[model samples]
Target: MLDADLKEQLKAYLERVTRPIEITASVDDSAASNELRGLLADLTALSDKITVTERRDDDQRKPSFALTTPGQDISLRFAGIPLGHEFTSLVLALLQVGGHPSKLAADVIEQIRNLDGDFKFETYFSLSCHNCPDVVQALNLMAVLNPRIQHVAIDGALFQSEVDERQVGSVPMIFLNGQMFGAGRMSAEEILAKVDTGASAREAEKLKAKAAFDVLIVGGGPAGAAAAIYAARKGIRTGIAAERFGGQVLDTMGIENFISVKETEGPKMAAALEQHVRQYDVDLMNLQRAEKLVAAGDDGLVEVQLAGGASLKSKTVILSTGARWRQMGVPGENEYRNKGVAYCPHCDGPLFKGKRVAVIGGGNSGVEAAIDLAGIVTHVTLIEFDSKLRADAVLQRKLYSLPNVRVILSALSTEVTGDGQKVNGLTYKDRGTDEQHHVELEGIFVQIGLLPNTEWLKDSGVALSPRGEIIVDDRGQTSLPGVFAAGDVTTVPYKQIVIAMGEGSKAALSAFDHLIRHSAPAESAKAA
Candidate 1:
């Protein structure tokens, strides 16, 4: 908490040192509108502050104003709550009003600028999503580049009533021109394509698309978000498909070892990344789902059919559609996942230091957890259904070296014996002999493999590996020229957030290459 004298001194110092900035704030009539009014009043009091702009339409409805600033542009929403990383989003809006260039690469800027159309985007997000910040940045850039394009970002927490009113059930939902575009993380290019083509189709009464993007990425996971940012920065108009925005990262309890940023939760990190990528405006679609993806033209144009009877056309597509952790099918599993039964050891291991725990599954994940837990917990009992351990030689040696770790081969978890509140123990059975055993513990770690959320892409023409992963080259390119893949759902071995993000970046860069080459002919023809 800042003292009154300190706050006053800080405000005065800011006022004296900063030059005047042009920005505006608006207020609406509602119970939650006080926040907007207060923010405006505070800014108005400060030098180089946000100005108050109020206007009413003929119907006497208050308008949400777009205020211009030296470094960026801001959209004022009274009675709107910006929660989670949304506070950062608000700051980004101010930055946009201040005219700050986005953190995206130069190439993405060129690609998005070349596309033609008017787009109105509204992205609804919660503070929980790890990738929502990217979604906001993408939409904000669209709002910046084209005045015809309007973007609105709504916070889920502060506006629960409004969220319920809109029937938004999840984090990171985007609505393009009053249509549900899907949720989760989407690239700006994909979003713009949808908007441009949707409008064109509506006007012409047939499927009409003006331009084809080199690659379209779906899902803004570590893989998808990285793909969009890198692709856009490299000058590709990439599009994204998402159900809520952010992807599974948002649900992650905590994240550490993400490279540069050593320790940060999922939401904060996602927000920062999103802010960096929004500069390219790479056609992000939040809360939008693809119903069908069919090949369109010989030029590798793929027609993505959305759920709302709308269609988007793209030359190439990157399938960064990621995977979800397989839930423990036991009755108490859902009730105590984050509470006790954790899937990610890196994220939640520290929380159980010196505690007794058991690791489930027979594969490498389970063995790895047993080894990791041996150091953190008092006793680590590894339960596996297969008769033999599945870990590599080195990992097996490591697990054997740990005295606290014990392996139970041919064992399967029959029930997650818990205290009915949090996880406390587990009951397992031998697969071959039907022998049952019980272990006392404080936590349970489910180390089973994750399930890829690619059921919807069964016929999307993107090739999947035997392990149900989208097969991709080093650059995240799939067997198809236009389609790329990334993340855990892809063939990338490392399932860490950082690895997925890196793959996403690679995919985006590859997409940009495709676009630049495709547009070269058009650019040369125009030059001629």
Candidate 2:
């Protein structure tokens, strides 16, 4: 099923296998099963250590296969053809099961091995989803590391009955032991923290014991990564505490405007940013959300209080907390989230294939989402609050060209109507006529805009604009002394990745200049 070039690459990757591996598949007379057989045949032809066997009477899902080492009790299964974004997941599973060393940190590997009890994880994913691979690869690695853990990555598109029965309207929807675990992109560390209840407390204690940093960045998006690298290059203690590295960038699908790079996806760019930051002597902490920022007191240090009662002290702080998707904030929106309401068209569009959906916005994101969905869904209704489309003229032309798309101008989304279990329609009102209307649909994609992640800074004595963005001078200096801000969270205009990175570098340099000119009494005495 793989092309010639892909086969050559697969062969090169399989050369890393140090042990024998077996593939046991359960198939029926179906097109997907035949395709799975072809894939397995190609895989077996690549490496001498690989073999495949088929058993029709197995109790597992049809068109599924299990990869296992001969002498090991570990096994990772795929209940559907794992192509598209999941192709990397398939390669990683093959090499990992065949004794290839994993790249996870030693501590994280040990933690995975130490987890108690059996974990049966099943993740539903669509092939087009950019965020599904992370979740699939993480769980697959965990299953490979721990013998008690078993994971099955299921293709939601291929298994319509299972998707309908579980009411899975979004990609990367995970379930552990038959109960819903979570939805969306999740890292291995996040998964471990959830299953292991004491993991958070242990992590908090570790954070509390860390020494004060010279420059500490709050956020791990493009801006935070740039700040950490710049500070570390100056031979100072630099650290980054992020809720989730990559921030809103992780949710993005296509990025073509990032100068130099012709085209790339959000997850790939995020990985590159993280990899570049790791080359420096920066303390990288993930999944840590800053709850409060305390201004400098008697010790000339700023304190950042974490959500789990852990506080980090730093001489200078750069806030690049970034932004998140703006919610519609209408009735039933929250109650039906993931059930039928979604913000990411790239991630959740495939789940609503052949169904009717609504795009709530008229800007570039919304217009683009409508254009993309028109090809997959039966029909798309584009709702906009403005009288005219805010997208580029080219995009508007393309959107208008689609026969399956209908645009509604000067309309306001009032409420998201659902059938208690899932969304069935949407309610809106025409602005000019003040006439209420309801459109029957299966899903709603919200692409309004972004809101700065500065709610925590509201009572923290930091000067903020009316829109809740942190107010900063040209030097990236915030109203609070020794504290600065950057990226989408700051007052800087044009929230682009390149701009954020530049702003982050400027903020780091500004912080360093402050340190050199206004050295603390102890440091000045030491220099003497």
Candidate 3:
């Protein structure tokens, strides 16, 4: 049975819910002196407990504090933008202030509690980024351990002005005293080392070894992901840098013939593949752009600078930026992308069920889309610029097997016909005989050959084939020293999810080997 006093207190607390209170100047007040007067009045109210202030010191005023109760002031110089990891940190901070102490290791807590000087840390990130969540929690733990350190997060998208002011471009950006730390996901120890300088400069530099791993995998696509997994599982500290978590796999619409999984979507498969690699201690970064690569110290470590100028050093680097669907570059393609024009049949296939659609291109993707669409749609017209379909014989056989599918050989898309709101049909011309025709379609699936996402590596010393694939060895080693390449960006043929995953595992293992070799001297030196 609850005590009478406790029961009454609980009831009172439940009944006292109110808006987060604040005292501010009236909208009509324009003079600076009037605003100052408003501030004085609010402070008086705060002292008397007449009102609770959410924001400390009204906008554009110096901070003035009142600790009526311990940790009760929920104040900020800037309104809580609360985006990305910072949002989670804000919640944690509120929870701590609201009375639930965070559960960090006692040692980590002790280290933070002893800090004496002011430490202001700002993290920049995007909410949509997957890896930002982990790094955000790490920072929150540090904040919980030390009350002297003021932590803040700025949303890269919503707070574009702040981001531009700080020159932030990517998610999971860490800025300590206006100096850029690393980007994407980072460890707590690295951050702590930078702030708490207890070691000698030479020792600190060695301890702050940016890239510990020998091989750095640049993509989380099939090839790169597989490489990282294999290398890290074999006791290598392989690091993978990727713009998005799943890489090209995330864009794939569907996977029907990838060995074990008979039917699956791109994102789902990528997720499963990612989960497989998560068990290892690989430093995987999703939604991070690899900006520049230059050789680091004599240990063969290559420092990779990210979009926000966060540098990481690794001995081996793998370039596995896969290919994307070739765009039509025509007018209506961009305007009605999600409206009616799509790239993946698996992702957008169900939406067009029983509707008429056109499959553009004569390659394997085009043939496969035509075959797949024929079963789901009322009719499927397979359009090809060349006189003959370029797909394999088995896929061509399947295309011919579908009664509702028609093969338009030697035809090119002149223009996509849409009703301004959505796609309606397409106008095409024959390449061989120069004939023009129009066909109504509810959806148009583009299945042309893929284009490599190597625009950034144009001058990065990594050799790209004439077809734009990164030239890599069987073990995912690239042309450049201390750099490896894998997956769709490489010369590997047959762009399939399983193959990419396999390649990723292999690349990871190779990178691990490189890491082991590089760490040997350091471990021996420590022993000595």
Candidate 4:
């Protein structure tokens, strides 16, 4: 069931529907059918425009779902209950089918309308994959607009046999026309580009040529965007290369602690960030991975070499390369990353509701995660390798306040044990006594720490913390004179959205100051 605010939002979004949408389910005596029934009932009760009806079709072979107006057959179908992040997918799909405006670009909708052939998109996704929702929403919107396209978002956990047959290790693995098309989080534009054959192709192509610049930013996240915007405003040639713009923000879910904003989802914030950056002529080259970082030598020009051999050179560089999740380096950890084990509790916790789970690490992140999960999940076991929890006393108190949470200290997470299908439990060791024990649970959240994306600059003489985070001063200046760093990749004490944005602005301003102090007046001035 949706929260009050979310329910209100859904109501407002669905109120414009000029047509009635009936959610039909092929029911049986099974709990799965009942779950489908209950979820649909809650959804239909939201508005008079929506209705639910079920037929006792015990002989049906496939999963059940149908969403169309009464006395109409152009209904959308979902094979399973859209739980976890997929809940968003369900609501968005309803809106789209009920005549809500398409979230895709106008040109994209035109392209979708012109598509030929009966193309089916079978997207294998786990409810926990934060990247899955964007793709699902886009695909569902396209399906709503185009009659030729059929998008089915299947839960990888629910259909483990199909997932194993395809050897799917991660999601959302998208298959088009019954063949694997692509995987992971791709923009709606990119998805259409993959299925198109016209002008859109030329427009959506990844950077074909790299242009020289005065300041080359290595990332397209908040830090890089801030740096580029600041440099561009100074009339300096600025360029940015991002593997994917928005960095970790794309993999995040609900963000309530972003300062002024009351609430916003990750994808919405990411889109807005990109829109703001694009307002300036910051030569944004997305989908470009930075493979090497070269410090300026006698030439006094730094070069950021991308993966495809296109290099962008500039007078200054701001390393905003973000950090990634610190994986539990044990067997089956990688195997079942999205299958049952997850890192972002905010994105995945709802999937394990009424199910037992374990949190590895007793730091603020782990303890906070355990406390949050306690409300949704049946039980949460918090594990820490040290004698005491590293979290603040305040957070520890809040964590201890939860009755469903139990803390275990001096414990080392040994292995994430699971079936070939999905995670079933986890094995940890008593660090003090060297005794190993395994606890049965449906999920494991590894919240040890973040590993910075500064490995490319390791040999470039950038000062890094012992844990590999780029060390920066108060002014965002790195050890190297012309280089600055910000965001989670830097030595910032708290890795947060507002802090990252502020650090990015500081880094950009610092870079600009360096240019004015060291470079020629002609190059420093706007006219130059």
**Top of the candidates by TM-score:** 2
Better of 1 and 2 by lDDT: 2
Model 3, residue 252: displacement in angstroms?
4.4
lDDT of model 3 at residue 264?
78
- TM-score computed on alpha carbons, candidate 1: 0.51
Clashes per prediction? 51, 0, 24, 0
My TM-score estimates for the predictions, one after another, are 0.51, 0.98, 0.55, 0.77
Model 2: per-residue Cα lDDT over 185-243, one tens digit each: 99999999899988999999999999999999999999999999999999999999999
Report every candidate's CA lDDT.
0.65, 0.94, 0.64, 0.79
User: Candidate 4 at 293: error in angstroms?
Assistant: 2.2
Residues 1-528, candidate 3, lDDT per residue (tens digit)? 234654454334423322232333212233433443453443333323224443334443222211122443332222223333243443444344334555654755666677667766776555444445455656655654555665555445444456545544345667776788666455454455456665224333442455466567777777777777777766656677776667766555557888967887665677687788788888776546777767556666677766644667766777777888898877788776755787766545545656789889988878987887677679998888887888999999888988898888878788887877678888998787777889988788888888988877777777889987888888777776557666777788887776777776676666666566767999999999
Residue-wise lDDT of candidate 1 within 220-317, one digit each (tens)?
Answer: 77777777777676655666767645677666646767777767877666666666656776766555566776865765577777664666778777
TM-score for predicted model 3 compared with the true structure: 0.55
Superior candidate under lDDT, 1 versus 4: 4
Off by over 4 Å in 4: 1-76, 79-103, 106-119, 123-132, 145-148, 154-186, 189-210, 254-256, 262-265, 297-301, 350-355, 375-378, 401-404, 460-463, 479-481, 521-528
lDDT of 4 by residue, 141-173 (tens): 777777777777777666556765775545777
Ordered list by lDDT, greatest first = 2, 4, 1, 3
Ranking by TM-score: 2, 4, 3, 1
Q: State the lDDT at 385 in candidate 3.
A: 81
TM-score quality measure for candidate 2? 0.98
Model 4, total clashes? 0
The reply for model 3, stretches above 4 Å from the true place, is: 1-212, 251-268, 295-300, 353-355, 392-398, 401-403, 505-528
